[model samples]
Target: MSEAVISLSNAFIYQKENLILSDVNFSINKGEFVYLIGKTGSGKSSLLKTLYADLWLEKGHGKVAGFELENIKYKEIPFLRRKIGIIFQDFQLLPDRNVLQNLRFFMEAMGWDDKMKIDDRIMEVLELVGLPDVLKKHPHQLSGGEQQRIAIARALLNHPEILLADEPTGNLDPEKSIEILKLFFKINEVSDTAVLMATHELGLIERFPRRTLYCDGGIINDLTGNS
Candidate 1:
């Protein structure tokens, strides 16, 4: 049986006093690639934020990468985040730094002490993402797809158990989006990392169908129940 990477049971996600999603319940198993599909403002991002501890779990229970969310302490959040990777629509690479330097900075921040180990890991992730020679390139020197590839490489650097991607392909063209989606699938298959990717592009879903969860009207419907 596959291990559970993310789980939410009767959870309520809120932004301040406003409830975004109600009674959220789902389990994404390890090595499973699940698509989170919904319209804009339909609570996809809210649910992902709650899982990553960006937003507090106001009610019920949630667990991600072995961290309990219902009662997670404030200071314990960083520790929780270290176990999972988060990707965004925007490729938030530092402008002044080259790709290698950026990855090194993140590794240092993530508490990688040995320089040799960090360098080895950088190469590993770059190779994993199928771009091994762009370490010297700046974010501005790369195309949108390359920048996103760097973001994915950075996300994989820490060997996260789960990757929480919010609109990762939202900013790319159709071809580029398909390439990014393929990379995600490759990562899921090769590294056994569970992925919960939130996107509104149903075309991508139809092109690369996995189990899908639909968010609407403050409710999440698991379209592939018991699969």
Candidate 2:
């Protein structure tokens, strides 16, 4: 069996006085493609935030990408982030920097210093995402789907064990959405990178069925009803 890449046990999250997530429990094994579905305010983003250490764990236990989340030191967050890739709904690419520069920034931040190796890695991931020709294009120049692909390439800079995508296809039209989804499918099939995506698009879920975790009524239900 594949190892558990992310594990949550009775996890709870709070935003000041109100509880965002309550007693949430789910486990994502290595190379598994899982969908995280919930209505607005269902704590989908908060849950992802908690996993990536964006929000603090007020109660319960959670482990992500081999790092224990609860009571984790602030300084360790960067290290934890290194093991995971996070994709946001809004492509967070720099407005001025070209594709290669944006990717290089992340590599540099992650302590990659060799210029030759950095260029090679950037090219490798861009190719992996089918954007080999986009290295010179600015974010504004690329189409919506192309920009999202660049974001995915940026996320792959570290070859992370897991990819946490929050509404990755939210901004695209249906056709483009499918294109991005297929890209994700290809990535998972080829690299065995576990993908935990939070999305409202049920069509994609129906089209490419996989393990699902549904969030509703302040509770998370693993569709398989298993831990």
Candidate 3:
């Protein structure tokens, strides 16, 4: 049996007091690559947030990276996050810090204190993202795609079990977007890390199809059925 890294059943997702999605059901097995698609207001982000425990799962059962979403405690949020990587459309790199510093900061925050190990891990992830030469560059010094690559490298720092990306290619051009998409697939294959990316790029989906979950009408439908 495939090990599920993320599973949601009868899940209700809420943004503050507003309910975004209801009756959500799905399971993403280890090393699986899945897409979440829908219109702008169709709760794709809400669903991702719920999986990562950013938004509370109020009325259903959800499990991610071995952490239960329902009734998760405040102290456990950081630990939950440690087991999952999150990528955002906007590259969230600190402007004042260079690439190496930014990565080191994240590793330290995640409780990695060994200097040599931190440096080695940073180089490993940067190489994995194909940006090993940009260790000394700042975010503004890099192009949109480079910045996004660095963000991806940062997300891989702790060897997360799953990667949660929210429109990671939204800010890039078509060529760069496809490049990023390919990189994600490479990571999925090489690292055996599951990925649940929320995106509206139907063209990319057509180009490289995978199991997809569609969010609409306040509910999630697993289009592939196999999930």
Q: List the residue pairs that clash in candidate 3.
A: none
Q: Write the per-residue lDDT of candidate 2 for residues 98-131, one digit (tens) a residue.
A: 9989999989999899999999999999899988
Give the poorly placed runs of model 2, Cα more than 4 Å off.
none
Clashes (N, CA, C under 3 Å) per candidate: 0, 0, 0
What would you estimate as the lDDT of candidate 3?
0.93
Candidate 3 lands at a TM-score of 0.98
Q: Estimate each model's TM-score.
A: 0.98, 0.98, 0.98
Per-residue lDDT over 1-227 for candidate 3, one digit per residue giving the tens place of the 0 to 100 score:
99999998888888899989988888999999999999999998888888877788899899998898997898999999999999999999999999999999999999999999999999899899998899899999999999999999999999999999999999999999999999999999999999999999999999999999998899888888875
Of candidate 2, the 10-residue stretch with the lowest lDDT total is 13-22
Per residue, candidate 1 scores C-alpha lDDT tens digits across 88-132 of: 999899999999999999999989999999999999999998899
RMSD of 3: 0.7
| Cα TM-score of candidate 1 | 0.98
